[model samples]
Target: MYNKRFIIPGLVIFVLFVTFPLWFNAFSTASPVPKPELPPGGEKECVAPASEMRDRHMVLLNEWRDGVLRDGERDVITVGGKQYRKGLQMACMQCHTSKEKFCDTCHDYTSVNPFCWDCHLTPEEAALKKETH
Candidate 1:
């Protein structure tokens, strides 16, 4: 036995709920793409190549974290014959200063909540919060 009358309403309710989050997110204001500023010399190159960094940053960070915490390593990474520190605060955040402008833009766009921010604060974000009365 089939109830065609009930089927249509049930499907409509299911679809509405299923798509509601996507619909609401789409209509919400989107943050602009991040344009991270370089340091005083206007140095443009990253320690690793840009394409590799774009795809493998998380992997590199995880490796660095493990090397530091688990192995008790001093966390020096050599890339392209140059040495660099492995800490996000030391290396990465030097360029990607504003987490709101840089990290949050892409994370929000992709709907990802990275654990990085939970443990670390960008230098710009370290400022004291203004209290409201």
Candidate 2:
């Protein structure tokens, strides 16, 4: 009688441990189906004019600056919905560096001279001073 009781309890425990995991795995594998893409038969696509893009960019910049000042949140200035944190090299300076390719591309296309050096010193000058010391 003692042996039978122990065996029954052990068998119940073994079945529970083995079957529970398999049942969970089967349930988890039954994922929902994805939805279909929207039909492309719509109105003609409209490209934003250059002036409109510039105006929109200025509005976004103002909104970002306001959020930074008021809320102290860095989610204001986002690219592809990713927030950029404030830091010396991690902020806007990351892309607005003197020798970067992005600056040249805009300058070449717009024929506008970038007056970055008027306020900020060049990176080459900073490096030279560091080397001399």
Candidate 3:
């Protein structure tokens, strides 16, 4: 055990370095969970409830995309007395008009880049496209 003291200190230093992030994060106060801006005009209802949509909106969107594109189920759905066509730009964007205010808040906070933008243009983008063309 000639190098016992050096080995022990080195092991302790290595463990501290390895676990520093965990312990530091445990003590540091995290930023508040993002509250995405609600839709304007006091529109409170969605095709589904808020809690369900919050958790599963992506799943619902994927289903809608598949149904519309793959299965050719271009049907309108009625929820809460309002009829909505089965598409993102047709339905969701109608209410959640400002992608920055409504969608970007949560998406940015969660560090996600949803693939929705790959196909569907934002209102700003649409406007720019209109001007260009």
Candidate 4:
């Protein structure tokens, strides 16, 4: 009602500031999400389909952890006639051998620090250690 000159500009500035991020990004091209490196072996199969693995790999790994540690379900799994041990080191790292190439790219892109390493070594390194010991 009062000070139309000052009040109008102040409201305009506040609105622009609030919407700046949305509008700024709208006019600019966003960086595309990085594609993860595939297995070096060129293996075409995974325990789950590619879509499921992309979206829910963390959940799947968590389930594996709980199943192995809590339920003692350490049995082998068969998929597409291939046998896989019910563990990360034994199954996953066999093909996804490089942590940086296979794991870190996507994990870094999403900015999630998974606690998987707290209790387990990078599975490939663990495998090497086992062989040497």
RMSD for each of the candidates: 4.9, 22.0, 3.1, 3.9
Which candidate has the highest lDDT of all?
3
Best by TM-score: 3
Which order, best to worst by lDDT? 3, 4, 1, 2
lDDT, candidate 2, 3-55, per-residue tens: 99889999999998989978797777643333322213331211234467345
Clashing pairs in 4: none
Q: List the residue pairs that clash in candidate 3.
A: none
Better of 3 and 4 by lDDT: 3
Runs off by more than 4 Å, candidate 3? 1-13, 20-32
lDDT (Cα atoms) of all candidates against the true structure:
0.73, 0.50, 0.88, 0.85
lDDT of 4 by residue, 1-133 (tens): 9999999999999999999999998999875687777888887889989999989998999999999999998989876677889887778877787777878887887787888777778966677899999
Worst 10-residue lDDT window for candidate 4 reads: 30-39
lDDT tens readout by residue for model 1, 50-118? 789879988988888888778888766664455668788777766666677666766776788889878
Residue 53, candidate 2: alpha-carbon lDDT: 39
lDDT of 3 at 74: 95
Lowest lDDT block of 10, candidate 3: 35-44
Q: Can you give the TM-score per candidate against the true fold?
A: 0.69, 0.30, 0.77, 0.70
Error of 1 at 59 (Å): 0.6
Q: In candidate 3, what are the lDDT values of residues 1-133, reduced to their tens digit?
A: 7899899999999999999989998999886677777777567789999999989999999999999999999999886778889998889987888899888888887798999999999878888999999
